[model samples]
Target chain A: MPGIEDLYREIILDHYRTPRNRGELPPPAVYSEGNNPLCGDDIRIYLDVADGVVRDVKFSGQGCSISQSSTSMMTVAVKGKTVAEVQAFVRRFKHMMTLTNESETVDESVKLGDIEALQGVVKFPVRIKCATLGWNTLLEALTEAIK
Target chain B: MVTTLTEASHNMSFDSAVIRRDFPLLAKQIDGKPLVYLDSANTSQKPNAVIDAMANFMRESYAPINRSAYTLAANATEQYEGARAAVAKFINAKSAREIVFTKNATEALNLIVSSWGRANLKTGDVVLLTHMEHHANIVPWQMLQQERGIELRWVPLTSDFQLDLTSLTSLLSGVKVFSFTSMSNVLGTINPVEKLCAAAHAAGAISIVDACQSVPHSPSDVQSWGADFATFSGHKMCGPSGVGVLWGREELLEAMPPFLGGGNMITDVRLDGFTCAELPAKFEAGTPPIAEVVGLGAAVEYLTNIGMANVRQHEISLSSYVLDLLTNRFGDDITIHGPRNPELRGATFSFAFRGIHPHDISQILDQSNVCVRAGHHCAKPLMKIIGANATTRASFYLYNTTTDADTLADALDSASDIF
Candidate 1:
């Protein structure tokens, strides 16, 4: 059995307590919301994208440590990255969260940084949705920004 | 014999320690920790008697009921009907024929909304509901409103979490049907069913009580409540899943059309049309959950032996212990979203702790084998009213003791430390 320590690492708790880029961006920033109806974990991602790059990003939501921390981490991870880079990073982040036997061989081209702390969330299958709620909302916001 | 046993147990002081021994799951250990199950509001842990009854029935007298004329089939039918009779007696219903078996309480509520709501209600017809109702009671009515253009009105809550009945008269003015939960599944507020039903009747409307949360924990009398329809799930009362009871006034059941059409729900059939079966059978429709019903019978018998009055007494005491422990220890840091009085609520406690998310709290508690439900608890409207996206709910039952309550408090301490 995976212990609680694995799921709630110090890095994760730190990120949850003092989140980075934790405010909403006003319009002309593309915005999207994601929620887990089961646990009532809601996430909203705001993105300011220009010239195929995410110029700025912020997140505002209320959820468990995994979700809120992931959202906070997500804003920092994608803030200065191009749309393509952020999209690829989202795929890799989600890949880490997936329950695949081949998860050990995740593409290491992009550094996951603090987001890798959420890799432990996959052990608790139910919290996987929590750890990914931010990224999913980010993807939605990215789609809206590009369009 | 059952009445004598129930009365005898009621006089004696309720002993949860002795009662805990009856449920095999309470003895279970996870990760070197004894399981402190406090999610009975979700689904109860079945006693050994229910488990054995179901297993023994399947092993000894397993046969399809009501179809074959064979001796085995006859005996199976007897046991199946016997379960229905037990459920009727448990709830103090007028007759077993008034109890219609369904998949679960959701299906039971759906049966009422789709069958009775459709036949009785028209466009612009009003169905008054309470704010604390489970989604089962709310969503079906909403569906009816969408399809038939019926109006849905809600009875809001007071500042202290109890139902605000001050405007119930005006709310029921134009209501053709008034449906509400006998107890709030989230807040643990026990509604005045008899009073609500009387108010509904005074306004010339029928009452449907979602007794899912109340029936298992307390004494239920459909006749006394003066309700037209009442529904509850067996699994929430130490019974197995896949079986639920919908007790209705016989006349109304007789008048309404069958919800499902298949074997066992009809008497005579033709290519053109079919005649529906009488009372309960008309609504049962399919080959019922025979073994689960038998298990439910055992569960009803177990509760009857212990007496629901005693069960309610145990919960009251436990609720008081939990309330004092959580509030006194946490102080302003913890916010329990229910009536402070034990008499006003069940042992179910939906609380917010130190700004910690309910999911995180429950997750940390799970490390200590303290099982609790964390979410909207299928009462989203009440969640919104309480100003929480979700709340951590720890619900107790007849088998739980004050020690379990203490364990929960200690676990909350650890959760705060982690967060």
Candidate 2:
């Protein structure tokens, strides 16, 4: 059985206590919001994209430590990456959290950085939605930006 | 021999050990620790009596009811109808024909909305509901408002979370239907049913009570409440799932159109139209939950033996103990989201502890084998009104003891140490 410590690691707690890139972006920023109404976890993703690359990204939400800290880590990871790179990162991060395939192993190619700490969220089926709310909202913002 | 209510009420004392023994799940352990269940408001743990009643019925006389005329089918039909009579007597309805068995309390409430609201309500008519109603009560009316262009009025809450009836008259003005919960599933505040019903009558509106939370934990008399319709589920009352009771006035049930049309609900089916059946059968559209109804009947008998007044007294004492313990121990660190008076509320306590998320608190409590519910509790509007995303709810029933409260407090202390 996975313990609570596994779900709330020290690094995750640090990110939650002092979140990074938490605020609004200027005009022409790509923005989208997502919320898990069941848990009352809400996330608004704001991104500044220039030249097919994320110039800046920020997230603000009120939720459990898992959701807020994961958003903080996600913002740090995808800030300067290209839109394609961020999309790939989102896919890999979601794969790591879901691990839905039987024959699929963890792909070592995708360097997850601080977001890897959230892999333990797979153990908690309910909180997986909380941890992924920010990433899902970011993808939506990216799509809106492209449109 | 069945104990009379007077005899049962005379001995108002509760024996938690004896009551706890009735439920076998209470004796189980989780993670090597004894189970400390405090989530009765969500759904109750079934006693052996209910389980055996269902199992024995299924084994001996389980057959399709209301269709076949064989001896076995007759026995099953008798058992099923007997359950309805038991429910009618349980809530003191005028006749058993007023009680219609549905899938669950949600379905029961939906039956009222779809049958009565669709038939009687037209565009621009107003329906009054309380802010503290569970989604079951709120969503059905909202569905009607969207489809039929009806207006919805809300009875707001006082600062302390009770219904603010200061604007009761204005809110009830021109309302065609007044529907509300008898108790708040999230706040545990018991509404003044009699007064609310009288107000609805005074405003010339039909009164409906969502007695889901109240019916199980305390005595429920739709006649005494003077509500035209009331609903509750068997699963919440120490019975099996897939069975619920909808008790409506005979005249209203006779007048309303059928909510669902199928095998058992119609009197005659033609190419163009259909004539509906009588009161209870008109609402019961299909093959009903026969075994579950037997279990519900046994649950009613069990609660009658225990006496609802005694159950309420037991809960009052338990709530007082819990309030004193949690407050005196944690002080301002804990914020219980209900009226402080035990008499004003049921034993449900939705609280925020030391700024910890309710999910985190529930997870920590789970480690100590302390079961609680964490989330919006299907009452998102109430959660939003209370200004919280979610809350950790710990509710009690007759089987709970002061020891369970102590276990919960200790578990909370453990949670705080980590958070």
Candidate 3:
């Protein structure tokens, strides 16, 4: 079992303490809301897209550490990526999070970035929802952008 | 059976080392620290009494309750009825016929709304609920609302987390069925059911009390409260899982259609139609949680031997001690939700330390072997009402102590620093 040290490394806490892209985007954006009804986690993801690119992204909500930190990390991951690339990353992130060792592999080159820290989540099944809340919002917002 | 309020309070105490021995888990250490479990409002730990009661039934007299025309069958049926009777006595229900076993309190709540609400509630009727309800109480009615087009009305909670009775009066007029928690599992608010039931009746609404949190800790008399129905779980009171009690008025149970119909729930079956089994049997379909019901019966007996008045007083005193400990140690670093007074609350208190997410606090507390609940706690609307994503909660039972509270306080201080 990977220890909490792997998940709560200084990098993860830094993103949580000083979140990047922590504000609202302007109008003409696809907006989506994802709430973990069981745990009281609510986050609103807003995306600024023009011509198949995510120009900017922002989110705001109240939740526990794994959720809010996950959201903060998600905002940083997708901010500068193209719309299609972000969607693929969402699928890859979800697959990696499910931690199916036989069926999934993450690109250690991209480093899994801030998300690599969340590997400790797989050991705690109840907390898997906490780690995925923000990622689900990313999917929701992207779907809205595609439509 | 009801004691005066003062007497009940006076007889309860915070010094209960003997009670701690009853719970085997309380003595152990977690992560090299003594286990300070305060999540009873979620689900309580089982004592030997409940465990032995279940093991005893499985070993001495374990048989299916359905008809088999044998000695074992008769014994099994008797034990099942005995459990129903025990449940009725525990909650002061009018008859054992009124007790229906469910999978959990959530399923019990669903049965009432789906079965009773469908037959009685019509379009444009309002189902009044509080914002602080567990999703079990909210979502089932929302399903009904979608079908029947019933208005989903909220009895807004006050800023401090108490039910806004002033707002409730206006919403109660159109309400056909009123469902609410006797005590919030998360907020620990103790609502006055007798008075609330009175108002709901005056407004011509049937009251359904979600006693999931209250019944396990306090002595309850559903008959005196004049509630049409009340729901609670066995797991929360140290009984085994897959067993919950839905105590409704006898007439209401008889009148409502069978929630789920299968072999055991049917009296007569034909190609054309089926005659449903009477009263309690009609609602409980398929095989029931036999061993669990027996365990719940033992739980009632155990609580009775300890005295419910004593149990409730112990919880309040422990809650107050923790409240004071948090105030003295953390002070402004801690922001507490719900009423400051333990009297106004159940055993649970939702709070947050500034700059520390609940997951962080809970994880840190876990390092100290302190078991608490973190997250929305199945009370999101309440969470939104309180203005937080999540909060750390420590709920107690009769077995908890002030020493446990002190440890929790110390853990919070460390957690605040850890975050």
Candidate 4:
């Protein structure tokens, strides 16, 4: 569980306590929502993307710590990245979660910082969705915005 | 089981201290103390009778039942069918031919959707379910909705957790089937099955009750309830897992097509077409869980000996005790879900602590050897309606006691402090 300590460790607690970019980014902008009704995880993700880059990203939702913290980390990770990079990061993060056969090379370089604490989630198969809710929502928002 | 334990130590009666010994898994320490098991609603622990029934079946009658001519196969088939008869009698069904074996309640539900539902429900036919149904009851119908364009509607829960039939009058109109759970597994709400069935019957709708929660803890009579079809699992009672039952009306069974087409379900097969077997067998394909069926029959006998009335009384009493203890101990600090009155509930009680996550609560409780189910428990929409992300649930059975309630309260008190 070495990499796992990165996913569930205390630093993630700090992000959960004081989530960065945790709110709406006005109406004329990107919007997306994701809900894992099973665990009552629902989130509304909004991003203010200017040109090809995400100028801002934010989320607000009610869920367990794993979901809320993961959302918070997702906002932090995707705020400054390009739409394509955010999608790739989300794809990689989901791969890390499912740890399925295809997701061999995870986002090893993108230091999610304390968000890495969620790496422990791979062991707990069921909670993987909770750990990646925000990232998924971000992807959805970007997908809609691109279209 | 009772005999050996009684022989080892002359103690009988439903005492928590003595009953805990019956559960072999209860011996291990969880965190630093005795583990408090609280998630029986999702899946109850196997008592000695259930475990022994399975073991005895495996050791003594280890042959495939039905569709064979061998002597051992005959005995196995008879015993397996005898179990089906036992289940039929348990639920007051007319005959064992109406009981189709399944892996769990989920498959039993799928059988209806795949067989009777697919054939009977046309496009635009509405499938009405309650909002409090477990995912098992909801998802299969969702498939019908997705694939066949069948309309799906939910009967919302009353403020106190039971179905509010009064509010769903319009929704019931034009509905072909009224499928719902007899009891909420997460909320522990004991729904009024007769009233709901009466409503559905009046509306010219077929009723399929998910009696998985109620059948194990209380006596169920499909005829008495007037339900078109009812489903439950053996393990929820004193039986082994991997076995479920679908109690349908003989008319429905005789009419519905086979869900899984395999060896036993067909009487004859040609390249162009095939004829179905008989009632229950037609629905049950492949090799059924013969040993588990036998064990489930033994389980039915075990529950009958104890008496279903006694089991219900014991569980409701325990639930009241648990409610009293939780209300007194945590008060406003924790939010207990479901009705306040014990008469409205069955064997489970779910609660969420303020300023604490249910996962954290379960993790802490586990340290004290208390096993509790945390999270949405597959009742996510219900959780949303209740305004909580997750909850820790404690369920009851005939074997549980006031002292176990006390131990749970104490450990939860500890969990409260820790979280």
Candidate 5:
């Protein structure tokens, strides 16, 4: 059995308490909102993509530690990466959170880093939505930006 | 404005410890700790009586009902219809024919909006609903609005979380159907059913009561409420899932078209068309949930034995204890939504703690085996009104005791420690 500490890791709490890239991006940025209707967790992701490079990314929302922290870590991870790289990272992060089988292998190059702390969330199936709300919104914003 | 725990307990009619023993799940241990279930508003824990009744029916008399004439089939049909009679008597309906069995309360509400609403409401007709209704009550109306071009009116809430009835007459003025919940599933605010029903009647609108929250927790009489139709789920009332009751006025049910078109709903099916069956059967299409209804019958009997007055009293005392303990312990750190007076509310408590999110609070509470719900509780509009995105809810039933409240408080301390 996993303890409460496992779900709310120290880094996750730190990110939740003092989030990075917490505000909106400037104009010319594409934005999208995602909501976990059951938990009332709503997040809006803002993206600034210029010439295929991810120039800036920010998020603003109210959610639990997992979601807020995951979003904070996601912004830090994807700020300097290219649009294609961030898209791959999003897929990798979702895969890590929803680890369908223990035997399934994760690509080592798409490093999750601090976001890997949220792997414990897979145990609590209900909180997986909380952990992924920000990432899903980020994905939507990226899609909107390319369009 | 706070009642003492001693006074509250003294006023209660039954001992919760004794009632707790009737439910086997109350004895369950989670993570090596005794389970403290406080999510009765979501769904109640079933007692041994209901479990045994369902099991017994399956073993002794389970058969396809209302379609066969064999002795065994007749016996099964008798038991199934007997559940309908129990439901009818439970809600004080005029006749058993008024009770229509659907999959659950959601389906029951959908049945009304599709069947009765479609027949009566035309384009531009108004249907009034409250801000605090569950999605079951709201979505059905919204579906009708889009498909039939009907309009929806909302009755807002007061600052104290009760329904703001000052403009109710104006809200109901052009309304063809006035649908609302008897008690809020999240806020626990008990609405004035009879008064609202009268207002709806005076305005020439039919009243529909979503009694899913009220029927299980308190004494409910549809006739006394004067509601044209009332619906509730057996699962929320200590029975099994897959069965719910929709009690409509006999005349209205007869007048409306059937919601579903299938086997048992029709009396005669020719090559070209079909004639619908009688009142209850017309709404009850295809194979009904026979054994679940038997369990619901047993659930009603079990609740009757405990006495609804006593059940309501138990919850009142429990609610008082929860409010007193949580406030006294957490002080300004805690914020409980809804009326402070126990008389004005049910046992449901949706609250926030410090700055910790509801999911975190619920997670910490689960460590001590205290089960609570943390979400919008299917009332997004009400959540918006209350100024909370989500709230951690701990709802009590007749089986809950002050010890459960203590466990919940102790668990909260752990949550605060984590945050």
Candidate 6:
């Protein structure tokens, strides 16, 4: 039984309070919207991809701390990485989120960094969608950028 | 035993502690903390009478209803139809024939839209709805709109979250049907059903009241309300799930086409077409939720024994307590999104606390075993009107006490500390 402290860690709250890349991007940037209709969590991911390398990322959304902070953390983690690298990171982050038990270990190859704080979300299955809303939107944005 | 409990409740002043004892789940503890359930508007915890009735029916009298000629089947049919009678009496319908059992209130509303809306409404026909209706009421009409090209009109809300009916007559102009909730599930604002129904009648539009929220907490008289049709769910009224009631005027029900086609809904089937069954059976298409219906009957009996007036009185006091407690304690931090007056509302309250998102608030509240609902509450149009993506809703019921409200305030204090 993980407590509220585990889910709303200080790091997650900090990211929620002061989000990173919290604005929209101009033309030449691909964007995709993601919505969790169940909870009314809406996220729009704006991506600036150049020659297979992710140049920049930004997110704008209104949702709970888990969702908004995850979006903020997502923007920071995926920026300045290759598109493939970002894709790998998303897979790892989702894998951590889908883990039923908090004790479950992730693959040693991919490091989640601050996004690992959201692993506590797996304990609260309903909030897992909130934590992954941004990552799913990023996936959609990446799919659009590749096209 | 049930009778004694009911008599005790009726004889004594409204006591939530005594009422809470009837519901088994209220006794449950999470992480050594007592369960403070404030989400009765979502679905109520079933009382022992309803639970036992359902279980007893399944154990002894479980059989095919209205199909077999066996003694057991007759008994089962009697119980099922008895439930319909109970529901009819509960809402003061003219006859049990006016009541049609469906899967849930959503299904009941959909049945009306598909059957009556399709039969009566033509292209450009307008259906006036309120901003407070749940998706069940709205989406069915929308689906009809998409298919039939009918126009949809909305009755907006006042600043105080009540229906702004100042221009209702003008809005009711050219409207074929006026469908709205008797009580707003999100805002807890009680709509004036009798006034709305009369206005619809004067405008030559039939009124349909979604009484899902109002019926459970308060005494409902559809006849006095003069609503052409009314629908509600059993689950929200301390009965089992998988059952809902749709009560319509007998004449209107007779005129409408059947929504679902099956064995029970038909009188006789030929090679080309089939003759629909009479009145209620026309709408009841298949083997209905027999046990759940029995449980619903028990629930109705339980409420009747205790008296709906007492239930309403208890809720009114609870609402006043919660409204004052939350407002006075939280002050500028809490924003309760409903009318400040407790007399004009049910106990259901949707609120936003200190800019903290509803999901986070509910999550922290969950830590203290304080159950509440946090989301759009399936009223997205209302949510948009309120300028909130989502709101934390803590709905009280007859069984809820001021102690629960105090626990909610205490837990909210903890939420503020964490955030």
Clashes of each: 0, 0, 4, 13, 0, 0
Docking class of 1: medium
Report model 3's TM-score to 2 decimal places: 0.91
For every prediction, compared with the true complex, DockQ reads 0.80, 0.67, 0.52, 0.38, 0.84, 0.79
**Model 5 segments more than 4 A misplaced:** A99-106, B1-13
List TM-score per model, in order: 0.97, 0.96, 0.91, 0.86, 0.96, 0.97
Each model's C-alpha lDDT? 0.90, 0.90, 0.83, 0.79, 0.90, 0.91
**Cα error, candidate 6, residue B364 (Å):** 0.6
Task: Judge the docking of candidate 4 as incorrect, acceptable, medium or high.
Answer: acceptable
Which candidate, 3 or 6, has the higher DockQ?
A: 6
Tell me the spans in candidate 1 whose CA falls farther than 4 Å from its real position. A99-106, B1-13
RMSD of 2: 2.4
Candidate 6, superposed: residue stretches over 4 Å from native: A99-108, B1-10
Q: Is candidate 2 or candidate 4 better by lDDT?
A: 2
Model 1 chain A: which ten-residue window has the lowest total lDDT? A99-108
Residue A97 displacement in candidate 1 (angstroms): 0.7
Which regions in candidate 4 have their CA more than 4 angstroms from the true location? A1-10, A27-32, A35-38, A49-54, A77-129, A136-147, B1-12, B146-150, B167-175, B414-419
Give candidate 2 regions above 4 Å deviation: A99-107, B1-8
Query: Model 4, residue B211: displacement in angstroms?
Result: 0.4
**CAPRI-style class, candidate 5:** high
Model 1 chain B: weakest 10-residue lDDT segment is: B1-10
lDDT of 3 by residue, B14-69 (tens): 35788788878778875566788888888899988998888989999999897778
- Model 3 regions lying over 4 Å from their true place: A1-4, A27-32, A48-55, A70-109, A113-128, A139-147, B1-15, B167-169
